[model samples]
Target: MASQWHSLVSQKIFLARNLLGQLENSNSVPAKEALLQGTIELGLRARKLVLIMIARMYQHQHSQPDSLEALGELIGTHSPEIAELNQLASDGRSWWNHLEQLERHQGNPPMARKTVSSENVIAVAADTGPDRSKQALETTLGAMKHFIDILEDRHSEW
Candidate 1:
């Protein structure tokens, strides 16, 4: 069972890395759209990975966490390193939420402010653009690499 969990983690890491690479190289609209969706997918994968790590390290139980917040509760004070990874996962989750909200609202401003239909959603999206996505991916990839190193160090214990 432990080996199975490890294999699953490894596969997710590979897929996340591949998506990051594709995102870095692509600039077309359709490609960027696909990659942004991929970011959301990878964010979920990251959450699952963190949950698995937390369960194995502390809880000794195998069950899906209800949400990232629930995972946070599971991780409470157990491991600072895992907490850092969870924070990164939260950031990844936010990227998708932010993008989705922007889409749903058609780039409208705050309610207190005048709502302008002339507002360009594309420009708003550009503000949170590929550059931001690239940085996020780089950060996630680095964290995953660190995670692998930590796992390798504890391989015998597992």
Candidate 2:
């Protein structure tokens, strides 16, 4: 089980990296959008996998934490990188939530009319712009690299 989670973490990081590369080279708006979406999904997966890896490592040294975030706090003691990665993870998650909100608002006419004000619509539009997507991709890549480093160091200790 531990090995499987480890493999998943590596795989997700690779996928997220590949997606960001593709996003960078993409010329069409649709292609970029698709790649950005994939990158965010893989980023989230990588974050979860790293959290699980930390939890697994903690199991041997101490009792398991109640949640992934708590496990991350414990691991943060070993490396400040974990706390940095948590901030990056939070940014990536908010980016995903913004995209979801835009999609949901656009898809539901009644809900948009009843709930989405002009200011909210403008916010959603801003969230869907390429600038934030590029920033999110860069953040994801940094987080992935840091996460892999932590995992590798942990593995090497064993």
Candidate 3:
């Protein structure tokens, strides 16, 4: 279960970075359009996975009929061992929520911050906001991966 969360985070972060890379090398409008749509959608899906995992981790399972019962069943049989996983779930949920809010801004912002004159072609890509967002997303995902690893490694305890 933990590994599942980590893998989802890594995939989404990778997509975001790839999109940022495409933007950096954007030479045509068609390519730019494709990357933008792909990256944002992938990011949203990844964010959704984080939410699902967290919901499964700590939410009490009750035998209510219909969809809510199905959700409970997906978490599997709960035990005292699950208590340790709650902290990881809480942290992951907080980070994912922040990422979702950041994503609501829509398409990537312009990368050229200092380049005023187009003739010089002096566009600096280092200060790009998209890159910062990518890095932040990756960092959060990496944290999630680490947490998952810690649990999976201690499978005996779980």
The candidate that wins on lDDT is 2
The ten-residue window of minimal lDDT in model 2 covers: 123-132
Candidate 3: tens digits of C-alpha lDDT, residues 1-158: 54555566567767766776667588998877677656666766665554454443444333222222343455543633334434333553444444444464454564445546668776455532333344565565555456455544554254
Report the Cα lDDT for candidate 2.
0.59
User: How well does candidate 1 score on lDDT at residue 36?
Assistant: 62
TM-score of 3: 0.43
Tens-place lDDT digits, model 2, residues 1-158: 45666777778877877878877678999988788767766665666556666666555344455444576577664555455544544663643344334345434444223367666565433233333456656754575656567666766577
Let me know the TM-score candidate 1 reaches against the reference structure. Answer: 0.55
Better of 1 and 2 by lDDT: 2
Ranking by TM-score: 1, 2, 3
- TM-score against native, each model: 0.55, 0.54, 0.43
Note the residue pairs that clash in candidate 1: none
Tens digits of per-residue lDDT for model 1, 53-123: 55565546765665556665675645664555555545645433333343334335534533457663333
lDDT of each prediction vs. the true structure?
Answer: 0.56, 0.59, 0.52
Model 3 misplaced regions, further than 4 Å: 59-98, 101-103, 107-158
Cα RMSD to the true fold for all candidates: 6.7, 6.9, 9.1
